[model samples]
Target chain A: MFDLEAVSAQWLGFTTEKMTAKYPVEHEPIRRHCQMVGNTNPLYLEPGYVEKTPCPPTAIPIFALPGRLPPDPKPRTTVLDIGLPVMGQGFTNMSREQEYLKPVYVGDHLAMQMRIVKLYQKPTRLDPDSLWIVTEDLITNQDDELVCLVRNTLLNFRTDEEWSATGVTKP
Target chain B: MSRQRYWEMVEVGEGMPEYQLEVTPTLIADQVSGSQDYNLMHHDRAFAQSQGAPDMYLNTGFIEAMLCRLVTDWMGDSGTLKKLGIQMRRFNTFGDKLTIKGKVTHKEMNAGEHLVYCDVWVESDREGVTVPGKATISLPSNQLNH
Candidate 1:
């Protein structure tokens, strides 16, 4: 078994030197995001509906959250998977916590930096060798203002071999 | 068009009407294609079954979009979503009845805005509370200028 705790200790507080989106937020991708959800609120799509609001273009739906948005061209994975590669184990998304701090606009250039905030291990009678990886992604807009904070917890299970190798039988 | 809910009209502990969301194959396909999250388990049934999933599961982006719709559908155009969070405990697979539900947990007046906090979840026939999360929204007051 690899030294999971030692490896994780090295990763705590690890953050990327901010990563900027390859492209700015676009209408087509935003439209696709809306259509997928069947959201027809018009604030995001219909210019006329938005015209009735205080700021016509300020009400784009949350689908346009460029702060946490995937790169324009779309890939199998997301830019937010900051710490998954290090664990080398199958994991399931357990929870996500977000705080929207500022308004994100379509033309804003969004960038993200991530940190491994914590590593929690819980040994249960049923799944004693499981652990949770908590990562926080601090997202910012062009002005360097923090627009969103997306924190996620993933339950990573150790394989039988891994459990045997770790020598800690009970989780 | 959906109902336009204002800050004055909503109250703490008020329950937002629940809606049924269907997880279909074509819908999942559109979601994966749109988000570019082509996880094999989300698109390929054979591959999914090999991994012990009964069928193709919905991707995280798709679920997030659906959750956004659930809130925005209630808040209307003037409302701004400050944050939306979700945690998945199980697969939102095809043929499941996704019942989206939410209730206001906390509300406060702050900095010329009405901030509402809610506890939300997407439950399915297969997995109860497959995705449970929280959201914070800033809405324009119906009575006062925000």
Candidate 2:
């Protein structure tokens, strides 16, 4: 049950070749994302309020997406699921758009690249057969500028008896 | 010391001034450990009811940082938020109470900034607009020579 035009003709225009951010913009993960969004907003908890803006353009969409931690734990893929092939387990997150051209201070160093601009396979009340994926993520820093631009809109699904009980086929 | 919002005193159906929060679980595990997105349906409510979700929810960078702290607490600290847009129809689970609303819906001035265009939302007293959004702020115009 997986042949949405040969998986969008091999991922429409697939892309994912730049991902750099081993560590740079710091300050306790932007104070743990403004204290888990309780956001005191003194331009992100006043580090002198606004003198060189210490960080808080809504912390640039959580450091422009970067996180994965678990000893040998790989199940939750992203970076637009590196090389898509849809085995659709189930996932959801319908939209997001962020643009913020510049503002991400502390130490800098951020980079990302991902693209698979769109794909829609209809029906979704949580998946009567859904598969709407749209990704963008352009974020850059460490002097290259281009601060942020995240587009994300994901929905992947699985049910046709979880796709024929994953007997897997269609490549 | 917040209080700036200028863009010539923004008006076009003005509203902005309604934000609330109360959905907890340590604010969803501090947004799943501050956005590392350990996605177990955002902290496993039995893995979000085994993916049929009836529990554990709220993550998309914590609803995009609570819709960027409800438009940066209503465009104050010299407003800039450039742009933000959201859509997730419903599912905010866990104690629910989120509020957050906005208005202004129009105002422009390109290249030189002074933007301001909103239409945010994120209701939840059980479900009303569980995240519907749009934003673009720049505001800071009192003719500072541009």
Candidate 3:
């Protein structure tokens, strides 16, 4: 029994208060991130090579997530905060859109705020009662300047239903 | 930062050099750790299986990073990623080899900013097109730098 109305009512217009990162952006994490992604772009690696340390704008989406720092983490909201009453084992990434408005540099403190944009109950061939959720995140710097805007869509559905619908044996 | 791909040099409908990457568990773990996603789907195979996923797949952040690399590597350090949009159609499971391809679709100057639009997609060996995306990059002009 999926309660579409109740779930939608709970998350609609739900936005979190701005939460600031514990520390300013550093070069070490950025370097490690670049290395892990196999990104050799000198712009993100070498500090003195460029006029300023340009944090990979793409990386900001990850950095914008909450709980990056534990042990008394700041109260930040995320798309995961929405708890649906559906019987789903997990959710999957559906899509994402990011708009970089301003450049983020090293030593800048980033603050993130997320909001639930909308939710749709669309059944898919793989699963019945597929719920699609859209979230919008605003990333700002210490100066309160908008750095980036990230909109993400996620799909949540019952694994058993998907298996049954596709007639595939569950692994 | 020194290298530059000038806006004038980019032509509409020009294909970029394809980038190939082999998907590995180590890479997936690295992405999870780097992004701090801590999502079970990205790490725990059992959890992913329980979710009806064939295997633990890459996270959204990782895919976005790959798309960013594809564009940055092509447009050089001077290029700026103004916007990026991606639609995930299939899961990029482990052991899949990915080929990232992109082409310049449009170019124009907007309010003194030289913007180049591109169509980008990642083709997975297991799944044809796992992620299709578009990017808006601002490239430096030779005149501006010189």
Candidate 4:
């Protein structure tokens, strides 16, 4: 049986203990990646134009911190592998709410500190045979400035028989 | 820096042009490396299939940045991207073509500041499924007098 209470309690104190990683921003690579991703705006790809703006582009900050979660060892496993009999999963990127405390240069070394901000367990509305577990991760840069906040929601389904055995409503 | 008067003559329903992106393995790899995301599912084809994913790996939060750029690009430099929200509905894999589009949905005047609200989405060309959900943004008032 999954312990909702225990899981919630564990998520409460999740923190980074000197958890850090660095990425070198090769101008060509960053620009090419931006171009390949269809972001060919002058502000991001054209260095001459970006020099005239307050921020190169929000994508620069995003590229500063790119993945779902940081690479670190923790007491609990990542939410991706949490649920059993996994049916399907998805990631809902809530937004990038931040303050550019300092300019992020091309060669700047960006570090991240991540923690589990929230977690919830709810029944799936789409499929009566499943339940959805949502987890939100808060990430910040080395300067203690907010970089990007990511919320990833994963869905898992119990077999139809499992639902019937529990006498749960199909609806 | 000369601030472009983006808000001086803006109108509702007016938006920037659309952009198309092709998802590739190298793109996904660079994103994973930059973000320190070593998840095998995003970079390993065999592992992804073993895990039931249709392809080797898919794009991550970078998609949000792409959509946000689409909005900011239309709004111009003086425009501040206040907020952007996206729900990942479907998976994007290598060889998949995606359409990044945005439209001005609402206009408002608050405390003498002109703001234009826009909605954005990223739809996959193959499945016609929107991989990212509705995004809302706030742009400066082009009507403001310097």
Candidate 5:
């Protein structure tokens, strides 16, 4: 058994500073990303497609690049860093919720910020020592408008018994 | 890609286009390169087996991309993807053919924009539903009906 308090105490309320990065919504990156997934959306492939579309060019790659996150810089704290306290040997991404607020057009710059919102432990019959780490990202276009709000929930499975000397039992 | 789908054109309960993709080593490698994800499991079979996995499997980042592809392919170029939510339930390893499907669950006019909602899911023979997702798409109105 692991010390629940020790693990919980180390990770709860642990947050990261807002880490920002500049991502340009360029045509090549957009096209390549779509191609990799075997997507044949002409709006993403054809020439002058953005201008020809019924919607504004801004909608061309709206909410694109998929959930290609965690590759980004975490600034002060890396939420996915295995080095973090109470970090587990196993990781499972349980869920993700994203809201696209504004359109991100090609040539527009994106100001992205990510931080760990909450960290807590939950008792499970399968793994009582698992920790749930939830992180959120706020992405804004160059115009300073919020483009998207993203939330990612992940489960960290830790089974090390070395840290249980405190005799913490599962709730 | 030739035809531009407009808001007035689509009907509620419409079935979006089905996307089928076979997960191959080269494709996964391409994704690893495209997403800048250098995880060994996505590329190294030996390392993955060493970690107790049956074989090298797909990464979460690629799944996200697949979800995006499912939504975007349905929305077309003119359609604005407003939201995407996905829950990864199973691991999609090599040689698995994923069939991504979705249907229009709801549609409404919000702030002069036609917002369409969809319930999306990814299935394979190995796993009935490897991933399930939801998405919101804003479409261009042809008649300008508010």
Candidate 6:
């Protein structure tokens, strides 16, 4: 059995290196990205509209990467390891919250920092044998302001017996 | 656009107007670019499949933003979104048709303000599975004095 308390304790005082990167708004990659998301709001694309509002729709809120963080052994996953399960396995992305304190233009540079906030465990009521582990991440900007917070829950069921024991029911 | 206050007439269990959106790679890419998310799983199909994603990429935070926008758009400027929670049950891939729907589930008076709880989700066009989530909004009540 995993030590719920011990694992929770590990999450405490758990910190990762502060990552800093600046993304120029004028980059073609940025423009292409804006076009891909289907945001027809001229504020993001039209340079003329940008001259008026000066703030692109792709700015601020979208610039905050929720789960962008360096890998830590404490959490036991790589950048690739993050996301929902493959086939038949159950995973739930609990929530993502963001707030924009300032505007970002096409040429503005955004600085980012990421850290682990918490880790906890819960049991599946449907399948007594299944345990669900959750991890929380906080991503902020250079000004030390919070941009977004993401909480992801991973369900670990090693076997069909465990899955059945956990009373796995499809929605 | 003039903002309208939603507090005048809203009841618990009232369904808000639905908004239909089409999700495409271009759309997903725009959101990803705006958000500065370079995760290949969201933009690159070959990478996503290598990582176990069914499709190339999916919209990240826009889903929640759209839901919040839905309420704010309906509530006009008078309502403020206080909290929003979402569960990404399945991947919303490129070129997927998404319908955002919500219903006011609960209402209460708090601290001289009218608070409404709404359950919302993005349903896949092919599969009806609702990405489960709920949001809370604080609106100026006509009866309540600020």
- Estimate the TM-score of every prediction: 0.80, 0.33, 0.89, 0.67, 0.77, 0.62
Q: What residue pairs clash in candidate 4, if any at all?
A: B7-B141, B7-B142, B7-B143, B8-B142
Question: Model 2 misses residue B60 by how many Å?
Answer: 2.6
TM-score computed on alpha carbons, candidate 3:
0.89
- lDDT for each residue of candidate 4 in A45-143, tens digit (9 for 90 to 100): 677765444343344444454432345432122544333223333322323333233445565445544455555455544454344544444444556
DockQ: the better of candidates 1 and 4: 1
Please provide, for model 6 over A8-127, each residue's C-alpha lDDT reduced to its tens digit, 9 standing for 90 to 100.
565544445554443433545444444443434444356565543323322344444334323222222322243322222333243454433343455554444444455444444323
- In the range B2-118, model 1's lDDT, one tens digit per residue, is 666888888899987777868787677677656555557677777665444677788766777777777878887668778788877678888888888889999989888898999
Please write out the lDDT profile of model 3 over residues B84-142, one tens digit for every residue: 99998988888989998899999999999999999999999988998999999999899
Question: Which candidate leads in TM-score?
Answer: 3
The TM-score that candidate 1 achieves is 0.80
Q: DockQ for each candidate? A: 0.44, 0.23, 0.52, 0.23, 0.42, 0.22
Q: How well is each residue in A77-152 modelled by candidate 1, as lDDT tens digits?
A: 2323443443324345667766667766566666777778887677533255566678787877778888777787
Model 2 per-residue lDDT tens digits across residues A80-136: 358587637777788878788887887787888888888878887656657788888
What's the lDDT for residue B95 in model 4?
77
Task: Give lDDT: candidate 6, residue A127.
Answer: 31
List, residue by residue over B1-146, the lDDT tens digit for candidate 5.
63567777878888877878888877877776555555565667775554335667776656667777767666665677777888877767788888888888888998888888888888987889988888888888888646
TM-score of chain A of each: 0.69, 0.35, 0.80, 0.54, 0.64, 0.53
Q: Write the per-residue lDDT of candidate 4 for residues B56-75, one digit (tens) a residue.
A: 54545466656766776677
Q: Which candidate model has the greater DockQ, 1 or 2?
A: 1
Model 1 off-target regions past 4 Å? A47-87, A123-127, A158-171, B1-3, B49-52
Clashes of each: 4, 0, 0, 4, 0, 22
Instruction: Give DockQ: model 2.
Output: 0.23
Model 1's CAPRI class? acceptable
Candidate 5: where are CA atoms >4 Å away?
Answer: A1-15, A46-77, A80-83, A123-126, A159-171, B49-52
Least lDDT summed over 10 consecutive residues: which range in candidate 5 chain B?
B47-56
Candidate 6: where is the Cα deviation over 4 Å? A1-9, A16-94, A97-171, B144-146
Task: Estimate the TM-score for candidate 5.
Answer: 0.77
